[model samples]
Structures are given as structure tokens and as C-alpha cells.
Target chain A: MESDRSHRASRRRFLGGVGAAVALLGSGRRAGAATPDPAITELPDWTRYLGEGVASRPYGRPSEFEAHVVRRNVAWLTASPESSVNFTPLHDLDGTITPNGLCFERHHSGVAEVDPAKHRLMVHGLVERPRVFTVADLKRFPGRANRVYFMECAANSGMEWRGAQLNGCQFTHGMVHNVMYTGVPLKAVLEACGLGPNASWLLAEGADAAAMTRSVPLAKALDDCLLAWAMNGEALRPEQGYPLRLVVPGWEGNMWIKWLRRIEVGDRPWHHREETAKYTDLMADGRARRFTFIMDAKSVVTNPSPQAPLVHKGTNLLSGLAWSGRGRVKRVDVTLDGGRNWRHARLDGPVLPLSLTRFYFPFNWNGRELLIQSRVIDETGYVQPTKQALRQVRGTSSIYHNNGIQTWHVHAGGETENVEIS
Target chain B: MSRFLSLAPALLVLVGVLALALPALGQTRGLGRPALPEEIKAWDIDLRPDGHGVPPGQGSVKEGEAIFLKQCAACHGEFGEGAGRWPVVAGRESLVNENPEKTVGSYWPHVTTVFDYVRRTMPFGNAQSLTDGEVYALTAFLLHMNDLVKEDFVLASDTIAAVALPNAGGFYDDDRETTEKHFWGTEPCMKNCKAEVTILNRARALDVTPDDKGAPKVE
Candidate 1:
């Protein structure tokens, strides 16, 4: 890795020398101002040597050169490694969808390795024919739903609730992942059991040691929830609930129970430990806001962030992600002078509802210091609020649901840092 | 409105439509068999604030303290004050100012949540190993430590709901749909959105963010 870094440094030095020569040749009329000829147009090592055969890596992985792209966790964030969260490298990823391997992981009692043969999903309580479904039995049901959705932890930017705390988008906006899930509709499974008239809530429980449970309203369970077994075109990675999981669209990620084992139909919410003691957002006045499920619209500048610094002064493509738990991101605006001026950024690729939407803005840089920010408006006409605006209402007491607009300060030396501008 | 009205021209046709949909409402295709009694008993372990699913057993505060020393003291500390970030459970009485210390005595809305959580995921590594009697005793001990009950108090399924938490009224239902309604709008200010913007805070100034090269240890 060190050698690769040095090689990249030399290549940059070579490019700088060649560009300087070309500029001198184009502008000067004096002698000895001509650009040098090409150094060596010879074949590299690959051209003379035999390459490795195809099956050398039957299941291929990323090349060694890209080793730096990885999920990272702050050691000081939690006490134990078992019950904590690791952030996704959002600044390193491109496009809207997060790759399965790079998705951020959060576990309360560590990941559970369950045998699919022994796993059973028991649906009881207010139902006509309460049933237990094995992995195979669940696949036999109809009305399979495949859709792309962004799952965000309610505490994605929780650390920054007081002020700008994390230096990179990977830490500020990384506790989220957008993926395509293939599963049967949760409504179909509930219908098979015959939901009772008074059934207004469903308690989804995990099989992990924590047995993490969350009470979901029945209206949402019937709306867009899924009994997902596959994600990103393959079986769910163990870190993200293997065998079966509940996909609660637009709700807080905790409600999307992983390693799902049982769901009980009930007339009222269970008010479990998760919903009351943990996920609830405390207000400034001492009273907490309970069951705040939807993650509001949020956006951030990816490139020229703390990690992905600007390296050149010419035209540069600034890209970032915008998403909403309410609906699709309709428009994204980029601000260069700390919200003093703004311009519409182009939305790239598919703009599906409740999914991550990519936005880009092209700008010619002259190595001047600037404050960059991005604001998103979702389909429901909800405008992303500033940190000041959110703080006025929620206060710094909350450690969850901090979806305030993020600011990145770009220095003249071509480095960036996280900052808050008022 | 006309498109939908044109389709339903007659009352007889509406009646016929209703007849077809009514049968489909309660119909079950019998794809999966009925859940056996034993299977339901195994997974139906959720308890509610109303004391719905607490197992029948009794445990005194004295019994709970003995069990806590053996099973939980390694992590929760001798007095439930918590050991090395392992969640403090008692004696947060005076820390309820600006930066509140949210312990079981001052924060949890429901005691049933405590009972249910401990019964299902307690002792950290050894979960669901505590008997019904032990869980009741632990509940009794926690209540005693919080001063909600006497040292000789005993907790059981029938009387769990009668015990109230100190901060039971500390929470309210979500009102974001109304409280934050002003955030929803058709147009937001673009040009001249702010004037004389100044930097309020910087992560670099705080210097808490870790180095980017720290590799995550995945289990």
C-alpha cells in the first residue's frame, strides 16, 4: 500500500511537470520554451507476463489497489465491539445504491448465525389461523415485491446534533444504505393468516441474543412492508439479517427487525424497550417524542468532503446523495457561498420513492476558499432544514433523528473539513 | 369523478361487485397449516405495559439481590451503578437537570419493559436462562433500589402493572406531523438565502473525529 501511494505521488509530479511544460510552450515566444518529448512508450509488466487464469478467484473480490474503500467504526463511539455500529464509506461509494458489503452495520447483541433449517417465523395473536412458517414455506407465498429503498438509522447523524462533529460524509451520513430487496409482501403473509378486525399493531421480534423487538403500526405493515430474504440480488449478508428480515419502508431502521423470528398481531403498540428507552427523541423541554419513525429529507456534498478532497483547480464534478423517508427527492439545490447563492443540481439515474437519489453539480474551481452545502426537497414538498432550524425545535438533547443540512468548508489548499455555518 | 361514476352505472352492478369482493375478504387459502399450541408458547413471549404476558412467579428483593451478585454483578456492578459503560440501572436521582441521567429509576416509561427485556435478553451472554422466579426477583430488586418499594417487597406477574415508573409521564406521542408542518412548502428560498453567514462550529476545532485509516473489526 505504501509503494502504491508513492507511485501515485510520482505520477502526480510527472503530470504537473508535463502540464507546466505545455503551458510554457503555448505562451512563451523565447527560445528553450519547447515541451519535452515523451519519455518512454514501452509496454508495462502485464504485456510480457502470463496472467492468472479465470478460476484463480471463482468468487472475485475487489482489487488490492482499492483496499482503502471500507466501512469504519470509531473506537470511542461505543464500549464493546459486539454492540455497536460501523459506518459506511459514503464518500468512497459512487451512484445511489450502496453495495451490500459496504453497507453500515448496527447490532444490539452482535450478529446471530442462525441455521435456516431451524428458523421459523411464527405469526400469532389476533389472527384467524395463526401459523408458523419455515424458510421454505415463506418462499411458497405469492405477491413477491422487489423495490429499491433507503434504510436509515434514526441516529445517522446523531453525533452532530450539538454541532459539526464528524469530518467526513462517511461518518455524518453513512448509517444508511439503499438496496433493492426481493421479498413477499408482508400484507400477503398477514392476509394468509387472516388478520382480525381489532388488529392495529404488529410486534416484530428478532431471534438474536438481544431478541430486539419493535412495535409497528398495522397501517404501515399493510402498506409497503416486506418479508425480505434477499437484498442486492442475492441472499442477505449475515451482518444484515440472514434468512429473513422485515423491510419497513420509510420507517426508522430499527423497526426493520433483522433475523426476524416472530410477529404478533395486537390491538395496541407494545411500548417495548427499544421504542421507549432508546429510539425515542428527547426534546429540549425534557419531554421526549416517541415513535418518530420517518427520517426527514437530508443531503450532503460527497466530493471535496473531508475524506475525498479536491485535487485540481479546473472543472470538477461535485456529487452527493439525497434521500427522504417520506417519498422521492424532487429537487436538490447546491450552495457555494454558505447559502448566499444557490443553483439547481442535476438529478442522476432513477428517482424512485423512498430511495437514495444522486445529485451532481459542475463547477470550475480557482482554488478559492468556500462553504459548500446541498439542500433537498422531497416529493411531499418537505424542504431540508438547516442545523440552526432543527436545533431551535429539537435542541441538542436528542441523540437521534438529526437530519440537518451538512456543511463542508473547502480551503484554498484543496482540503475540506466539516463545519457549521449560521 | 366522471370516470369512476361512469363505471358504476347501476345499483345492481354495484351489488354484484360487492358480492364478489366480500367472499375474498375473510377467505384463507390454507397455504400454511395452523400453528401448534407448543409452537405459539415458545415464541409468544412479548409482555405489554398492561402486564399482558408476564409469566406467573414471585421473587423477593432479598432473593433478587443474591441472584444479582451471582449472575449480573460482573457487568452491572454491585449496586447496579454499572461497570465500564454497561448501563447504570439505579440511583440517578439528582442527575435530571439539563444533561439528564436516564436510568431505570428516572426514565423508563414502563416497568413491564424492564421485566420483558431482562427475561428475554439478560445476563448479556446467557439469555433466556433466567427462570420466571429469578426474573420476578430481579424486578423486585430493581424496584427496591429505585425506592419504589420496600426491601421486603415481592414482584409477580399479577402485580407488575401496579408498580409505576417515576418517569412514566416523561414521554408523549409523536407530533412532528403538526409541530414541524411549516418545514413543508412548495418553494424554498434559493438566491440570497442568507446574509453575512459566519462559521458557528467546526469538527476540526473540536478534534474528535478519528483518523480515516482505522480498519473496522468485523465479527
Candidate 2:
């Protein structure tokens, strides 16, 4: 059967080309070889209506496919790429702000541009009022509020206490974020500068060319602090400090000093080499801790983890992210089998004050091989440890508090591999 | 910041890995490319040390002593000596944590951060396009090459805050209390984490290491 007569003569030339496209659809011709209306292949009913100018947004970004949510680092640590710092993706992000182009940067003298209407913020020396303002005079002063927090980066787990290293959480847990912020409360601009009851330390400083300075404490600058100018709402996005900065929520984000400028109020604590010898911690008894601050209570599960995987396998979710500079996160758990049996996890939104909450968990993979891990806790009940209980309590001569608990294996065909279960 | 990862329950969870590089939504990606602005317009510059964001151009010290003897005294030796070996912009004063090396009018600490670092990086072979009177006569001949001021003195932006930096009050601001209540509780473990689950006994088990300095250093 000569190949079944060439498949019945190519099925009668495809049914004689479908009967000349049904006699060219009533003979007006233009039917098959005319495949060119694809500029949109569909959708143009006023672009499926969501218009009427959909409530304006003169500016605000993210969702151009998240442009890879940027700010990364670890170029062989650093020798100079105009001083360094770049960490901010926090597992593809979710909920609590952090979007001004993904936040986390830190430069020492490079990214300044500084023009916010010729910027100013100059508070100057021993004040009774040595003013300068503008960024619209500190957004026209007045309580302002918004809050939410978590800043972190006193070297968030400076490369594990000797383990897991980097394999992505965008370089492990991406520095830190959690946003909300807006501005002004630095105790009503240091009580409008006139509180000299022997001042006791203020020195802020930062106009950048490495003019970076610090030295706050006067009771956390009269508690809560935030000369900010807005984030998650607008304005301040010249790399998170356009016309002012100094939020200090949950501590350590280079003591929150970006493009800001001068403050003074002094009495002591100036030692600045970014706190003598780069964010000091070097211990193991050779002595070196200096004001460790506090960001503690950690957590991490981020989808299957190594950059996420496992797609279709009976219901799953297992999200993550938690925070703690001292308050919210009350409970996170996770442990798919690492700390041997554990669960809980829901959390989600407003876990406010020094922010970042999120958490989730649902599970049911069945493809086998997992291990996960999370932990957190917080609301003044700090939990997150393991890395063999933080190097058996801080020993391996520290390198800025490593926070700990983070694992994720997952195999069974979905991949992902950062491992550390013991 | 944020380097500790660990991950192992077979392979560290970060599932589905779309690799977040977002920025692409529906189509048409072909226009011979070069408009670049569907958004991104922030542009920061930072320049403090007191002159804050300085970008208007003003340098002096008599046109910065003829462009610091024509682009910084032959590799900075006509007085910034330390040449052939470079650096040595004059001896670092008290040498703060008394170092072993480094000088720029004695361990820098603000003179508007040496005119915002020679108006944005000095003649390290051209940077930020200097010239505010040759960065104020090479910051008044490096303040007479560190004896601080007077070679007939002359730095400008109206005297760069009467120049007084010697680690302008060194620095500090972390006031530690790390959210007390013992850094927010936990660590109780409901019951003996099995006497802290003993581990001891690894003796090196590394991989992926390649920090490439010469491409070799193993166990």
C-alpha cells in the first residue's frame, strides 16, 4: 500500500484545503494565506475596560514584571564599587511595602543626585534652633504618622555562622525591609531643636561623599524616632533618602542615615568607622562587640525556597517572612521535618511596629524529600536560632548576629538545594 | 548584610523559581530599542561633609593653585609626597585607632570631607570633572600639606566651614538595647532541645567555594 497511498493523498490535500475554505467563504476570497491580524491576536474592547484613566498615578512603580526587584551585592565582598551595599528582594516580596525600586542600597559616596528642590535639611550644631529644613520644611511639620517598621542590616547574619552561604533568598534573606513610614516624629523634630538639657548625643549627619555620621541615643532620640520624608506613599525615593532620612525602626540599617544632613545635639558616642571597624562584632573572645542593637527573631520558607519550585502536587503554599526589632511576629513555626515535626504559621498583614510579618503554610506535596524550616516568634518572645543554636551561643567569634534558622531542600524533581538540617 | 542561608530539607525551599526579573508584560519587544523610560527617574547624588549636595561648581585657592601644579603635583609629591607609592596626602594627625598606614592631613574626619573628596574624587585619573578653582587651590595646597591651613591659605565655598576636622567628634549611634525582654523571648524549647542536640564533628565539608583569586585553595 504505497504508504497507504501517501496517507490517502495527504487526506485528499486536507479535504481539498477544506473545500477552498468553503468556496472562500462565499467567494470574497481573503481567508487562509491572510494570517496577519495578530498585532494583538485579541483584546481591544477599549482594552477590556479598566479605563476612565483608571484613577491616575503620576508616579509609582513595580509590576513591570517586578523588574527583578533589585539591590543586590556580594561582589567578592568588597574593595570598592563606590563603597558598597545592595540587598533587597526578600523572596520576591509581598504585602508590607519595600518597593521604592526594592529599597536596600547603602552606598558610601556614590548615588547622591540630591536635588529635591535644592534639598536642605541642615539642622547644625548645639541647637536652640540652627535650622534649614526644606523638603518642604519637613513636610510642614505636625505628627504625620504611618509607622510599620523593620530596617535591619547590621549585617543580617553576615554570611551564616560558617555555613549555608548564598544560594538565593536573593543572597539569603535580602538585607531587610517592611516599610510603611512617612515622616516627622523625631520627637517633633527634636522638640523643634530646643531641648538642651545637656543634650546627650544626636550627631546624625550625611550629605554623602562619605560625610556619613551617626551617634543618636538620648533615649532613642526621645523614643520612636523618624525624620523620614515618606516611603511607600511618595517623595523620598532618591534611593530611600531623597530629602531626609533617619527612621531607625527595629534598629540597624546603618543606623538609618541616608542623604540626610547634619543634626549635632552632641555630648558623646561619635566613634564612627561605621561604629569603629565596620559595624563591629568580631568576637570569639578577642573582644569586639560594641552596641549590637537587635533584629533577632527570623524566619524563612519562601515558597519551596531555593528560588521556589514544586508546582503541581496536591495543595501547597508554605510562604514566609517575619520580623523583630522587638515587637510583633508572635509565632511562625514551619519545620516540614527539620526540627522534627512542627506547624502553626498563618500571621499575614499588620503585625506592625518595626514591621514585616506575612507567614502562611498549607502543605501536602507527596512527591517526598523536603525539610523546610521557619521559626520566628517575637512580640518580645524571640525564637529563631538553630545553626546549632547559633554556634553554641555566639562563639565562632561572631560577625554581627546571624539570626539562624533557614533550611530548604525539596527534591523529588522540583529541585531547590540550600541544605543544613542538623 | 543577609548572607546566612543554610537550607536543607532535601534542597532548601524557594520554590517555583520564576527568578523574579519581572519587567515584561505582554509583547511588542522590538523597536530597535533606546527610549529607556517607561519609569525609573530617581537620580541621587550625595555630597555632604557640609557642602551637602555641592553641584554648582565653585573651586578656588587661586584657581586651585593652577590646577594643583597641573593635575595634582606630579603624582602628588610636590608636597602630597608618598609618590611613586601614591597616597600620602599629608600625615594623618592623631591616626585615630593608630593605624599602620594612611594619611590625608592626618586621618580625615570632615573638612566637608576634604571638599567632598576633592570635589568628587581627585585626579585618580579624572573623576566627577573637578575645577572649583582647581578644587580650591588643591584645598589650599592640602592645607599647606597638612600642617593645617596657610601656604597663604585659600579654599573656597566661602572658607568651607572654616575647615575644622580632626574626626569631627569621631562617631556613634546604635545605643543598643536590641529590643530587650532578652531580645524578644523564645529559646525555651518547651522542653530540653535534647541537651542542645550535640553535633561536634564536621572537620570541613565545603563546596561551591571558588572565590577566584588565583582559582585554587582547597582541602
Candidate 3:
């Protein structure tokens, strides 16, 4: 409601103030790329400190050299950008930290360009004391937590349900990313509202044009849900909900509403469209499956993936990422020449609960056309299966939960293409 | 020496090109100038559920009806029945699990969310253009159409705090904490995982749709 011009100016200044310490001249533009003009003298200090500043970017971003890290959409999937999804570039880097800018995106009515200044998080359901927290007030709450978790869309591997639909990891396992969240625990804030004894469920709604809404179990909300204020150590980027978003670890990403503000606790799940019409899985029994909240374990190889081609016939360090919505990835097994032989991979980085776990497979290549694949084992003992293994059970008619082993065909020329074994 | 001298111009140009190309090739860090005082004062309009940052204003159902008809009815429909694929504004309750028809009246958990949504993004094209009074009025009218409120029931910045949403009781705060039960090595058993666990027949547990619609779902 505070629409003063000064307020808008202040927002601009905050961005301008982001530590652009190592301006590095043309760093604002693409790296190693030529700047249009060469005749200009020295630039200003602010401009000199152009790129993200030191200690400023508490959470680091991908190097400018890795500009290809992005979310890509399958044009054949849907027509509109607002109604469809674009996956993250899962094959581009090492480590579990997903840069805020490179995280994958799925939109209902498109990302709502909601202004944090006008946004408000309302909690007014089955509560004894109803209260609204200003962005500052929410920050003032006592409980704060820093946790790492991988957010996988329920539809991350949806393509493999039928067959290998896409070749690149960007399209295969790109619908998910892991990041560190900084925020107040949902319980701490809910307690301030004084929940009624009957409050057993929570309906989360977004401030987007779609007004995306979903019903979450009260047990889950008070369990691990975080009203996240920061991603990867920095205030969220606008695309990732600049002010705040709901972070539900180890669950489907859709339930993690961005630009979040409302939490109404009740005794029953509000069968919103997301749970009933859209997100639900249609079973072979002609019954529309619903309440499929948890996202299962899944993994894939990023490097030596489609876009990352083999430069030569030598020893290459092949690595990929594995994660589980149930818990930590137990181990990742890699097959260099198809499943004829399987070898264990080294799982690295912070192997936190329900977060992305990076796995590496060191192999010697002899320049022959080979079939490469990786399988993940979760703490729940769930093993990611092959595309054929998956479709044999759950027919290809589902669009929701698809956790299958993905295969990449490597050629003598070192080019990888998406393929099926059986 | 003469070759180096003759190629100096081009060499300098090449160095500049590399400098332009690799922006981070040579860089040092330092905090630049301080931001102006005005920068910190923005974004103070965030509204909390416990009632903070709410502006002053009030509107009646009669005043809001016109606003709704002119601004909302086009997309929401003349009677707010939600004519097309657009979401239905009212009617829905007990329709969730079994043959459910989700609607604002039946499924929305909190009425405050209606106001929160409108104030944040509404009317599709011209979002955030409505006055606080108009927002209150439209909120009341939408509820009225859902049969939750009387035809004359009015909503205002002050009165909105009291309207309880039907779906409000359908939600809860998430709080999952410990992960040791699900993660962490049990006995550092890196070798022979097969000995520790016996494999029974593996049955398919889930079936996901790969395409859009009418595809046969088998599991």
C-alpha cells in the first residue's frame, strides 16, 4: 500500500548497493567476450566493482565462464511459458549448491511479478491469536534455521515414464536443485498465532496471477517446512521469490510456493486444483490418484552428458548428481559399458538430509560407442530403476511421479544421445 | 626487436581483446561507495497475518459491486460463476477427495488470503491498481456470491480481520526436523550391501503421465 516514489527508489538503490566490488571493467557483460568500445578511459568505482562483490554474495554463484547453466523448456510439451516448465541445467557444475539465478522454474500463470513492498503473509485459520508479520517482524521472530535440501519437482523424471524423451541432463534431471535456506521455522511463527487444537492441515497459496494454492498436512508443515527468506545465503532473487517462499525439504517442489504469504491451519486437506485436477496421478484403475505429496529418490550423470562431449580418448572424470526426497543418497553406481559391469562412485559435498549429493565416476575411455548409465540408492533403500524397468510397472500414462534410471548413449565420436536399452 | 615493435599495435589490440573477453581474468575485490539513505526505507509495505502495515480505508458491498462488474466480471464472469477455464469464485465444499469441484467458497482456507491475493496480483492485466476500499468491497461481493455472506455484507480494512475463511482450518504449519532416521550410515557398511539386505520381488510403486491427456494410465 505504500506506493510512494521514494520507496521504489530505495529498492533500486538496494540493488545498486549489491557489492559489485570487482567491477573488473567489462565483467558486467559476458566473460572473455569483446566489449563494444575500446576507447573509453577508466570507469567509475561503482562500475569498477561491477560483478557480484566479495563477502557480499554470501552464497556463491556459478562462474561467468559457465553461462550455459539455465532452464530450458521442451517446446513440444506445452505452448505457453506461463503454463509450462523450464528445467535447470543439472549437468553444468560440481557441488550441491544451486545458484539462485540458475534454479529451474515451473509456472502456472507465469511467475507473478509480486512486489515485496506490497506483499503480506497472512495466518488466519484455526488459531487462537491471529497476527500478521511485517517483513521485518517475521525477521524478528526468535527461531532461525540454516538447512540444505534438494527441491525436486514431482515431475522431474516424468519424461522417462514413457521412454527417454530428452537427451540432455538439462531436460532429464534438471527440474530439481539443491540450495541452502535461511529462514524462520514454520512452527515458531505458527506458535505465535496460537493454533487451535483442531488445526491439523495447512493451505499454502502464492501471490502470483495464478493464485496457485495447495493443501499441506499440519504434521508436515510443523515438521520441516521453512518460511525461507534466503536461498544459498542471499535474499531470494525475484524469480525465486525475492522476499520469501515456503521451503518444504524432501517433498515435491510444487508444494514449496514462491512469493508465499498465507498459512491457514485446519483439520482437513483443501482439495485444491493442484492436488485434485493437475498434480494428481491417474492410475490404471480409472481412479484419479491424489495426495501424492512426497517425491521419491532419483539421480543422473551431468558431465559426459549430451552437451558435455568427450574431447578425446583418455581418462575422463565422469560425474553426476544424485538425490532423494526421502533422505540422503546412500550411494551411486555407474556403468561405463552399459550394465555389464557396475562400479561405485564417490559421493561428495555436504551430504545433508534430503539434499543433492554429487557423485563422481573416474573412468578410462577406449573410444568405442558405449552406453552409460548411473543408478542412485537412497537412505530409504529405494533404487532408481531403468526406463524399461520403470515403464514395465507404472504404465507410461502418468504425468506426476517418475523416478527412473536415465541412460545416455556415448558414441565413438564422444557425442551422447538419449537412448533406451530394451 | 623490430618484429615486436611492428606488431605492438596489434599485440596491444589483442591484449585489449582478451581483457574485454575475460572480464574476470584479472580482478580484485573491494566494497564500493555507500548506498544513499533512501535505499533502506523501501519495501516497508509487507503485510503480516497478525495485522501490520494495513492501510486505512473502508468500502461497502454496493460500492464494490460496480467495481467488481467493471474490473472483475470480464474474467470472473458477470455473476462470478467463473464462466470459462478461469477459476470459479464461489461454490465448493465437501467436493475435495471424491469427485471434488474446487472453488473459492468451498476450498479457500482464509478470507484474508482473498484480500492478500487481490492486493498483490489481480484483475490479470492491471494488477495492484484497485484502491484498498475497492479491494474490500470486491472481497465481500465474492463471498456474497459464494452464499457465505449476506448480499449487503460489507468488507473493509478493519472488518476483514474478522471474516474466517472456510478452507482456513484445512491447513497446518510444516515442521519436519530430524533426518538421522532417514540418512546417515548405519554401520559404515560400504561393502556387501547385499548381505545386509535381502531383495524380494521389486514391484512398481508409481506411474507418471509423460504426455498431456487421455493417455491410458497403467500401473
Strongest candidate by DockQ: 1
Among these predicted structures, which one has the highest TM-score?
A: 1
Comparing 1 and 2 by TM-score, which wins?
Answer: 1
Give the higher-DockQ candidate: 1 or 2.
1
TM-score (all chains, Cα) for each model: 0.88, 0.29, 0.62
DockQ of each: 0.35, 0.03, 0.03
Instruction: Report the lDDT of model 2 for residue A376.
Output: 82
**Tens digit of lDDT per residue, candidate 1, span B108-147?**
8898999899998997888999988999899889888877
Q: For each candidate, what is chain B's TM-score?
A: 0.78, 0.23, 0.59
The window of 10 residues in a row where model 2 chain A has the poorest summed lDDT is A13-22
Considering chain A alone, what is the TM-score of candidate 3? 0.84
What interface RMSD does every candidate have? 5.8, 24.3, 14.1
Clashing residue pairs in candidate 1, if any? none
